[model samples]
Target: MLFFLRMRWHWIVVTTCAFLAIAGTYLLTAEPTFVASTQLVIFPQVSGSEAQRAFAEDAFIEGQLEIARSSDVVGGTVAALDLVHDPEFVDQTPSLQDRAKNWLTGFSSGNGANEVQAQTEEERLHDWATAKLLNMTGIRRIGSSTIIEVSAAASTPQKAVDIADTLARQYIQKNIAMKANAARQYSDWLSTFISEQQRGLADTASALASFTSNPRDQFKLAELQSATDARRSLYENTLNQLTETKQRITYSMSDATIVSPATLPLSKARPRSTLIAAFAAAVGLGAGLALAMIRHASDRRLVRPHQIAETGGLPFVTLLATAKRTRNGHPPRFLAVGTGSSTTARPVIPGMAELSATVVGLRRKRRVVIGVVAVEPGGGASTIACELAVLSSVSGAKTLLIDAAAQKSSLSKAIAPQSSSGLADVLDNGELIETAALPLSPTLKFLPLGRVDTVSPAIRLSSRRTQLSFVELKKEFDSVFVDISAFSASPDANAIAPELDGVLVVASHGRTSIDDAMRVIETLRNVGAEILGAIINHAPKSMQP
Candidate 1:
């Protein structure tokens, strides 16, 4: 959360895009609607036709509502009325008028693939707008009021009015025309049948009159009467069917009753940008947190030495290493004792001071020569060697800090500016080792890793030199500290460990793997070297304190 809050720009960009997308959709996609409305009340027109009229009215009202959605109504309205020309509302054909005419004539039916071509320009346009514009809404009304309601929407106010009025007029005209046609057709058919029946009756009467003279058969008279009664029943049924069809058509088309006309709506309906932006921010925050957790999981680097100390229950002596630079940038972040400083990079911070004091407490003697070695060369062995010498000499006793690592010239570079002779010259060439030791303070002296040309490194730490140096050291120095190269990677520890009181292996925090440390321990053990204890060198502040 803190990291997210700090990255304000991320939130801003996400929220802005959300806001624009939502706001733009609303502005571009939303349509404004205007509605117009009028009312109608239905009542009986004839004294004898009251029941029929009521039935017609009821059915007609339902028909009108349904017709509003039919192709005839929508097509006719679009063809007759002028509306905005939008791509979604137009046919793909070049001839707009023909398209409109065909639509109005009920030639096109909107369907799959017919989405653009199935409808004429006018029909397509009207259908495209029907859900948005003209809606019969309902044939609803106030209680006890026979008024039927109508509603619609369009780009222009006048168009809304035109649609409402035209729809009502067309519906009424269609209904009246249907009722008139049905009545006329029924009346014509009835007249023709009545005339034919009259002619037949005359002939039958004449025949009967002739038969009566001969005293006609009784079964024939009965059969004639039955036929006459059947005809009458058939006539009645036909009359009823014709009447009902007409009444239904009339009721459906009537304009004498209306509930309300549709009117224009003042506002467009759709998206809220702020709401979208808020939701986007929430999603972005979640994404950021997930990313942070993933990064945290992927980091595979060792950090504190306490991880081993707590788990292994081993005491670690913190050592400072002489800082060196490899070809890699800034030497790895793992062991940062002091940067690029070949001099004394080691220091007695509070924790180390207390730790060193404790280490002295566990020892049996004050003049212990602790050889500082590590699993690797850059693990602050020289730094530990220097600081340990400082700490020992700081007690007002004579002390000598020796650099045992020959491959690296960090000590030579550091002490050459002050000392004229070095340990290498003394070991291999029998050069005077006493005059060149640098006095950093009253009791402390630093020996440079000096020139070695005559003798091999293996022989320098041999029992012969050990005896020679110890014999010389007892005369002037109370304690000596040997800083060796990585004994685990090189063979120096095995060669020199026998000459020293004990070997102190220095492992860097966050750099040396546990396997590497164990190997160094094993190597010292294999070499018959005395393992005094392990030292954690060049550790970060948090790891120390």
Candidate 2:
């Protein structure tokens, strides 16, 4: 419960953080991304020629479209735009190189390119251009037509448009250069072969004529004529091949053309602010819940009186959730609260009005011995012991709060700071118990912790004098509440608690650990202490500032 109260301050922090976190994500992920796109005819001219290629396949269209959208093409576009000079691209250049260089690098590297080193700045620039080009590149068959759609994205509308335009122009020019070179080479080769065949044909024809006209070569006329015919056939074939080559070059010239040009997009292509903000808010909420649960679980402190009750199988007799802390940091005031109902304010002593009640109850029942114990120190157990005495005494019962713990002096000082001697002094040094006992009110009295001049044994009670004093104090009084130390695996509470008519175990919620509370309870039970039940002091709840 204290953990829950502590989280009250967290709500404001969470709200502020969540809002800022979502806003920050929007700022990061949401950006103006202008996408420039254009439609290309895919030069449907050749696409129509392949009879086996169904219109449904759109294979050629898809292949070219993919190439248009490919990283190389986009990279080329980014390079043409000199995006390398952009610092963002520069910083990312190295990572781009790494991705292109390795197989798994694509998964690890964001841009899916090889890492760029300072020495290879140009290469990095090229890679960055490539990555952006790939991102901006979107290629698809134009509704099953040979046509294709091409796009590029940039921060500004003009940049997106310019990139798309540049890519289209550059790719077309490159294809032209390659095809023209091939065409020129073919034309030259065919022209050369045709020339060779023409020369051979002329020589064969001349030889055949000479053989036919000269008597000395009459036997060679038929063979020479056959040779001439073969050469003529070869020359005719070369001429035909040259005509076909020219026709192919003419056909390829117009096969691929950019029919529609790219235009700048008016808006950013990405960085959806609403979507990013929503995603961020969801992530923040989940993380906040996890963090809250983690912190609460780690705090290990007991949170409520009920936690103690459940841990020890004992009902909580009393609890003080928000008792005021002392100057020394322990609970200064005393509270006697019950279950279920919330305690809003600590009731003023009201001139021992409650003291009047406990006395009446005890007197009516003829109570004898009383024991005061705690699950742990710093739990205000001592404070409860002192207040109970004051109430009892004021109510007309001769009450004595015996300082049974030989270890410390907090009880005497806080309850009766001015008193110089107490039960310890009287028991250990034979100081007069009657003198040490202080008169706090007409009905209430105090027993101070004895003189510092005498050191008592750490373990046992002050002495037989204090023991006999307890016996004497109890004779006329309805109850003698012994303020004992927190439980140890010893027989002292055993010796004293059984003699008491009842025991009231004082414990503070959220201060005591479960193990400590259990050990104390078990020890008291072993001592055969009359199980008068438990009191959880300083109960769960936050204190007002």
lDDT of 2 by residue, 18-65 (tens): 876767856876667778877667553243435655753465566665
Best by TM-score: 2
Off by over 4 Å in 2: 1-43, 46-57, 69-79, 82-162, 174-301, 304-307, 315-317, 325-364, 390-398, 402-408, 428-435, 452-467, 486-500, 542-545
Q: Which 10 successive residues of model 2 have the least lDDT summed?
A: 335-344
What digit string (tens of lDDT, one per residue) describes model 1 on residues 20-64?
Answer: 666566656766545565555554343337778667666665565
lDDT of each: 0.59, 0.61
Q: In candidate 1, residue 141 scores what lDDT?
A: 42
Model 1 global lDDT (CA atoms, 0 to 1): 0.59
TM-score of each: 0.49, 0.63
User: Which ranges of candidate 1 are over 4 A from the true structure?
Assistant: 1-350, 362-366, 428-431, 454-459, 463-468, 538-540
Overlapping backbone residue pairs in candidate 1 total 28
